[model samples]
Target: MLNTFSLVGINMGGLKISLLGSLMCIAVLPACVGLKPSVEEQVNARIEAYWQAMIQKDYEKAHGFLSPGFRLKVDKFVYRNRFAGKTSYKAAAVDGLSCEEERCQAAMILEYTVHGVPPYGFEFNRTEERKELWVNVEGEWWLLPKK
Candidate 1:
């Protein structure tokens, strides 16, 4: 009793074993090698995107990154209102991150430029490190905004 199959366009017979198992392994190797990013990478990517949204002043977009729990409590209108008229975000970048299980803390640097304070025509640039917590909920990483 033997099964026949083709491998690399070559037909082989009289072998009791099929190359199907080998082919399946080869097809699935990429998944084992991580077709999707690791947890840390996912959190880091989300952190970067969240800051980019804030930098773009797309509060609605940034709001989308907030944890589901937070979103449920704060509507987009309130979230968007929190940033209205006050301008400070010039740039943002993820500096470091640590993760364990379903939680992560991301350290980011926020850049700012402020003008007309104390002096009528003086402007200043500032940068600060900000830490944000991210959590995995329903297999998706989202920012955990402080309520």
Candidate 2:
């Protein structure tokens, strides 16, 4: 009973509505009915994601995990240079990750091997201490300064 152009317009409107509904579902589903992840969990996830990003040389993604103050002082190029390409530095393996909310300290040891002179294959393991701070801003925990 409908003319061809009218039918086409109706189909187009329906398609747009369907697309908007899909987008709204995707956007809102994760935000409802949850207490939201805790600070420690968020930090751990960020650290893991950061390491993965670093391993893949995804500097932009890795930079997101850094504190805002740190990010402001250091650019992406500087961050990449500091972390990438160390002849002495092999790879980092995280172990025994723990978080203390009261102390605001997340502890993890990076297992790594450094190349030695003459014999480059000599494997050695070292644990490096990393100190990270967590601050809450506007009800969201960020790995950044409070101010």
* CA lDDT, every model vs. true structure: 0.65, 0.45
The residue-level lDDT of candidate 1 at 51 comes to: 65
Q: Over the stretch 1-147, how does candidate 1's per-residue lDDT look in tens digits?
A: 001111111111222232453455355633346576467656655765676677677899989999988999998889988765545466655556778899988776667656546646666667677788999999899998777
The collision pairs in model 2 are: none
Q: Candidate 1: worst 10 consecutive residues by lDDT? A: 1-10
What is the Cα-based lDDT of residue 110 in candidate 2? 40
TM-scores, all models, native as reference:
0.68, 0.51
RMSD of each: 17.2, 16.7
Rate residue 123 of model 2 by lDDT: 49
Clashing pairs in 1: none
Which regions of candidate 1 deviate over 4 angstroms? 1-34, 114-124
In terms of lDDT, the best-performing candidate is: 1
Q: Global lDDT for candidate 2?
A: 0.45
